[model samples]
Target: MAAKQVKSRQRVADHGEVFTAEREVKAMCDLVKQETERIDSRFLEPACGDGNFLVEILTRKLAIVKKKYKRSAYDWERNSLLALGSMYGVDILLDNAKACRDRLYEIWEQEYKAVCKKECNDDTRAAARFILERNIVCGNALTLFCVDNEQQDTTEPIVFSEWTFPFNDARIQRKDYTFAELINAEEPKRPKKEGAQQTLFDLYPEAKPEPDEEGIFLQQYITHYRRLSENG
Candidate 1:
């Protein structure tokens, strides 16, 4: 059974679906680096089956910092680790989660070796492990519970947290927001404007409207705007 399981995972890896290759990973990292201007950008991989995206992100971020500051390689390396916090991930499978964390630490170890110009000790490896264990949590990405349908309330936005585009409208007091909260907020009515308007309730109207229909509808609008902002 163990062997068969290994083979199955290998097949998945070969299909270029689960464990990503170094080159493709590098490409993804490059795209993120180019598009984002956040000094320490945060990235989240919703279905992070094995942390491939997060590892790749760390590699690119580390390289960027190293190029900018060559002299203080140690400090740069620490900064790179700190930057990993910005790179979030979520995986349902426990084994996959562990593997993902191990791969990230391995990448960190390799980077540390290259930066320090010397072999990394157990202490350094332990430090990397510590961070990985703390950050990589096992939980359902869509485990939000609606405490009050009308009001804006959620356990917390996890891996799938989204942001929306900017609004030139001065009427919108809160320009930015999240999809979940927006769908749950009290939008009495559609803003007196015309443009792209998509709602979760529209997608799943039968899913059961919250007690306070207005609050939840308006909340949905806020969430929609927030998601657009993030993508924009």
Candidate 2:
């Protein structure tokens, strides 16, 4: 059977929003068979519509995680979180973005519960949810700016968190960067002065360094896991 469609006809017309069928999603993903199977390999869906592509990618990664780490709960949890961290998405519609985040969380939560059972804790689940919120965002991929749900303005640049585990520790480290800077990192050129000659690369935004405190703040924000680890 074809995959269920998520958006209305008007939405499809207005935003050109159409979810890909499961079969096609799998077929296209299979073309990059090696990357999809590698747990830490990153995948970004520029026009992800309710995460049709991301959901499948996460599922594939989790399957690998399960096979390799099933016996070790710690390994399973850590690797699963890593898999979640690697899948990113951006959607124009707010509803689609929220739905995609929830869908991805549900996929992760189910597997986590299956493996961890009574050992599954809320802090771990919260960490997974937090990762999803940052990874899958509501934004205009073309403009590289996030859409404000209340004002429907594209004024804010979409910032994504990069999660890392230093020295195989349980602590999660996060660094944030604007989508514009990330996508244009290699090609950005400074804008010409009033009388200077123009260049093609000048059209791109110049990359800026992320604030040092941003990581500290993110670490503090997701304190549930921190506190739980301390207590344990």
Candidate 3:
């Protein structure tokens, strides 16, 4: 008999914990296949801790690609390795990030070796290695900013000023948006009822000041009453 599935587990899967189960992995692959008509696909795991999702995605995508093409086993392996670019990930921990990259590379290497029926070359290995390292960046995904929060510079380099290059150029600098600031700005702007309502008497028929009061004290009294009435 199969073991019982654990219930009441923690909310999110961390670095050590395996996030995607065997069944879930298959389900995800099915979803991907159904949604995308194209053989080539792209998948990204924003918080990929140890690359559980990426590994499954790579495995399934490769299998599908190989079956569809019906090429030789060598082609199958080459295409499988090439599928690494379809997957991307990000993790904060350096060690975990490195381990995740290594794990993905190992999967690629194993498939490549089987297809070649001989040792893999430096170029093939290097391609896999580069994809793993560069694609799986070491950074906090939560801190990641979208397009709107990008930096702007009126002061341009004297040379590039003539040509209209994008102010928020990726080459210029890597920009980061504050999650906190965005959240704060999104909060509802409360109406200024208190301050605005203070002058509400100005709209009333009796609101106009009386010039009929001739004496200084009477004028002051009238002014005070007007102020008090308006405020109240």
| Number of clashes recorded per candidate | 22, 0, 0
Q: Against the true structure, what is each candidate's TM-score?
A: 0.50, 0.79, 0.49
Q: Which stretches of candidate 3 lie over 4 Å from their true place?
A: 1-18, 35-39, 68-78, 145-232
Put down candidate 1 lDDT per residue, 83-136, tens digits, no spaces.
Answer: 554555656556666887888877777777777665345544554565466456
Clashing pairs in 3: none
User: Which scores better on TM-score, 1 or 3?
Assistant: 1
Tens-digit lDDT track for model 3 on 1-232? Answer: 4323332244233333334566775676677665333334656677676777787777666556656543464345345544765566766556556777988887777766655545446655664575466567555555442212122221211010000112212111111112223233332222223453234234443433344332111011111211222321
Pull out the clashing pairs in model 2.
none
When 1 and 2 are scored with lDDT, the better candidate is: 2
Off by over 4 Å in 1: 1-31, 35-39, 118-124, 144-232
Rank ordering of all candidates by TM-score, starting from the highest: 2, 1, 3
TM-score of the candidate numbered 3? 0.49
> Each candidate's root-mean-square deviation in Å?
14.6, 10.0, 25.3
lDDT of 2 at 34: 93
Candidate-wise lDDT, in order? 0.49, 0.74, 0.46
Whole-structure CA lDDT of model 1: 0.49
